[model samples]
Target: MPNKHLFFLLLLTAMALALPSYYFDSNSIRFIFFIGVVAIWRYLWALQHFIRALFFLKVKFKRLRQQEQAIGEIADPKHIFILVTSFRIETDTSILVYKSAIAEAIRLKQPVTIIASIVEPSDERLIKQIFYNSAPPLRVSLKLVRIKGSGKRDGLAVGFRAISNSQVDLESAVVAVVDGDSVLTENCIKNCYRFFSINPKLGALTTNESCELTQSSRTLAIYRRWYNLRFAQRHEFMCSVALSNRVLTLTGRMSMFRGDIVGSSEFIDRIEFDYIDHWRLGRFRFLTGDDKSSWFQILKDGWQMLYVPDVKVLTIEQPPHNNFIKGATLLMVRWFGNMLRANTCARQLPRVVMGSYVWWLLRDQLISIWTSLFGLVLAIMGGLYYGETIFYAFAFWILLTRYLLSALLSTLHGHFSLSWPILLYFSQIYGSMVKIYVLSHMYRQVWTRQKTTLKDSGNRLEHFIRTFGSNIALLGSASIFLTVVAFIAGVLTTYDIQAFISYYFS
Candidate 1:
């Protein structure tokens, strides 16, 4: 996702694309050509996003001005609902988050409802204290919805349902969904809410996010880079996707939606109970990634989602673990699990409804898990059988290409990091492995911060069978991949494979 990240991507694409006049047989050329073609196609895909993102920046600025003018002519949504979801959050963080929400509502000077969906009674008391201490207007009232520490999804549903039962007019109201740790910047709510009123079809919109880490023990600094790099990539991708009036996911950190959409019973149900019936996995329920569920439902119902690049949200973060690898792995497992679970979305909905570009984006999620590792496998095999020259060529290509690409990437995010190249490779390679594992064991889900997890409910024997089956699938897939690499690398011939098969059977 980082700019330098594309170095290996494009490098492999060139090797894959320019198959050239290899001395090997047609099969080898065909194999290389096929990989090249996929790489080239994705290379263009990323390139298109880059070009569109640049144009989108200008369009976003112009559109904001136009929207303000439009609002002056017509009335914008006067009623606002702020849904804040928090669980086991620190007291100081609770104060910052609740105060920020109150400030946003007070600025609007409209009849606003602030709902705190929390598990702790102390949080409720803290919020109430903050609310009265600010001396907020009578129009800005507070509501507390207590949950039994179930999860974020349940907390959100309870909050939304409470809003739907209120006296406000759902048709003309706008609802802002914010995580408890996320603090809004000045005019953050005001900037996005006006867009929903002017654009009738705009279902929801999310603001850009920046993060701050509180508890540091040396390893925390790497997470700082990780979060920023991810946020930077998100800013670019969201802007690019928003050009088509679609975003891959509506971030849970801070997003605003048309009240009717968020208030509907169907929408609440999607958040509460989203599941899939995979051919191999059978039927499994989702444990996380409620945002993806929300996005899918909104898009399916023929609504538009947008990204406001200018406005930002400040997210308060803590290190997931003292060991960076353990923390990073846990986070990726959750993220990629959400992605692989959302893979079937393209087929479930009508192609014409979601548009071709959006449909392909969902499909790309499925393909990327494999393609992310394809070149590495080829490079390793080529080194062993073909020659060391092929391996070193790949290594040298990475060094030169990443060093150059990283320089250009800094212009995109307005900052430069000497460590961008190393971070990018770890994200791509490790992220791919995590995706592959999650795809096989789609039933596993975890909330890293809360230490909550959900698995298929079964007895000891059934659980063993499930674990064994997943391991077999994972190892089996790896074996097939290596075999294919052997043939492609010219280490195994057609006769070699046939003779082996015959000998084994005999």
Candidate 2:
């Protein structure tokens, strides 16, 4: 079902055309060669994904046929545990999620237990009403776990403990961690269980996600919708990575795990108190990225994780800030910070433990930030001295390539829009800048959705100094660095103001 190879081929073709248009002249040969090297790396990355996606498709089709044959026969049902954690979640979203969970449980024809972890007592009452109101053929048990208005980690810990104490079969039972904002599709439970039944080695699995935007502003709505579409593209890439027994992140939006894995004390401990040894701040606790913590535990335990592309979950997405740009920036800060923190430890793991592809991805994360900025700077300087033709070519290249890629991906995923190509540019340029900033401020963590803030370090003064000081320093350094680079680029490119004036005058 994934068109990863086709997408890559089309992208490569577009880039090939665009690259020559900007770099065909002798004056830009160095720039051309530099970009060519970067393009080769991109090509290899794409090729690797294509190969893995093809392999996954072949295996998935064969497995599906076998599963279809087994579907008619009544298989012994496994105890299904659904943990729904919410902290100030929208009432509508919560109700929808509960209904979907109940519906899916009924479809599976399994003994189901739903654990609802809520910080607000009001949410608990509302969720209970939704659960009781459901009229499923099979009896679905409900467990309500109340928590102080602490954090998602605390909420999850409560649910995890409840599931552990319950009388569920550890070996065969499966635990689905569903975010309160996400509604599971009808086939989600059935499809996930099929994979588990077929592959004993599959430790944990996550499903594909679609987002529902709750914005009234047309501009913000477009941004959110396109942003989610890009997320789907990312999911496809992750699915391909999973063919090699590695997924970059186990998305918390909706992920399924073995009962034993979820019930383990280690998993709960990691979720609640996961931390990294920061050189500057010493040992620091993770305030977010619970998904990453779960992923690290699974990877460390030698469990084979997977991405079930066929399974879909609908997640309700609301912007954290009023301004679209501000909201997007805050989201990226939290996201990239979580990633970089986890990556610190992930890089130290053996290649056999994480797989070679994951290792390369970790390295690529570090390299990509600098490369992106460099490319942007080069284009700007090339335009300033070499004439607007070079810049026009660059802009045309980005627009054409991104539009083609978005169109192709839309055909595959059915979420394409005319605005997606423009959003693609924003994601690359603006998102890359955000990632670079987040990398520097890896110690900071905030739950933008829940309006929760955590200090980067223990001491208030130290946290302030580290957070604000680092930001200011980065700003100053970037300004100076760009200025010098621009000057150098202009000088090296040998621009002639006299020739430009004469030509214009003539």
Candidate 3:
């Protein structure tokens, strides 16, 4: 669901459609023209992200690997105030996240405080237990500031209030918002401080979200594993890389704000309004645009956001087989909402249009969807002309090629297992179908929010079919076109060779 995967899917679709088209009709100038336009636009956007990534990568690469180089390092760990937003911390996952963060805070030996927001109104016992369990000295100082509310925004607002009310000086302390489910690495705090010290322009630093899909023994762990790997390896880190200037959102999962940055009345205004009204009424808002909203605020305030890859955390992914449909559906819905929200923010913040970033984001989304639909139509047309066998064969070839490519990429990246190729294949099939359903579902959700029916738990399969059918059809068309090109090439080679022989003999 990350924009990275969406772009990758778009690129794959574009390649499948455009590459084979060269063989089918060399003289089709319009086709070539369209392909060129898409390719150029994609390259420019990628170039921006790539440049920023390279800069950070080079700095980190030298710092960690090179001993001779006196690269940036945190001499004195800055005074940091940790803000963890949680409804209740009784859950095993929540407890573990707190423990890890506490351990890291202790490791850094910095003054840290935790403010947990009690979101469930009826779960007084749970909240009490959570406070009782997390009480006192793990390493650094800790406080359990409980707020009365039942939503993500409420928790966030509560946390913000606690920080504001606390004696901690907002100007000097590093204010980091760590999600309840995120586990920080040992040196995460150190790396974050280091990033802040080196880049004075950076108002915030976000740790790379190192997520993994885990479950009990046996089942689709392999699939979950690969999915998480793809997500973390690329998407999780992309926001920092891609949105260097015009950051739309700072993720709540593992993002750090300078004490001064969030402590400001301007930045505090973010916690003031949830969506429409103030934070209290819309506290339990179901929308997942919190991160996007933060990014928008930072950009509006003219502060840059930095990403420290070394500051890694293991964010747990929702298991795929158990909750695939619900999970995927939620993902698509959230993404659609995020985009809509981002568009609104972009309009308010016209600086977003000053660069290629917005264009890249919008262009890719529109064209990618178009490519998927176009492929489906072409495949249906090809089938009507050629036959069913040809269509099926094309599908098989497309699947095979995708699996091989993904397998190779995973192997090279060393993030996925040997079995990743097969999982990638299934993901392709399932993801495509899910995408199609998502496209339709997104439209419905956006257009007719009031009359929306409850989604079935097992809707991923249905969504997968809707999404993948178009992809299969497109691949089929590409295959038929490739086949025709192969035939033409063979005939032309034969004719040229015969002509050459006849001329030589004469």
Every model's TM-score: 0.91, 0.86, 0.66
Compute the lDDT for candidate 3. 0.54
Candidates in order: C-alpha RMSD to true structure:
4.5, 6.9, 12.3
Write out the backbone clash pairs for model 1: 16-36
Which regions of candidate 1 are displaced past 4 Å? 1-35
List lDDT for all candidates, in order: 0.81, 0.76, 0.54
Per residue, candidate 1 scores C-alpha lDDT tens digits across 331-358 of 9998888877875754588888787878
Models ranked on TM-score: 1, 2, 3
What is the RMSD of candidate 2? Answer: 6.9
On residues 1-506, what C-alpha lDDT tens digit does candidate 2 reach at each position? Answer: 13754575576567567554435565676456335555557546656665566567568645754774586534334788989998889887888888888777777677888888998888878877877777655557888999997999999999999998987777778888998889888877766765666667778888788888775664677667656667757755875787777687888888988888889999999999999987755678899999999999988887888887767789888877767788878888888888889988788888888877777888988877665566567677877776666665666566666766566556446576656777877877887888767766777678878978774435788777777866875687677657655655654422564666678997
Q: Which candidate has the highest lDDT of all?
A: 1
Best by TM-score: 1
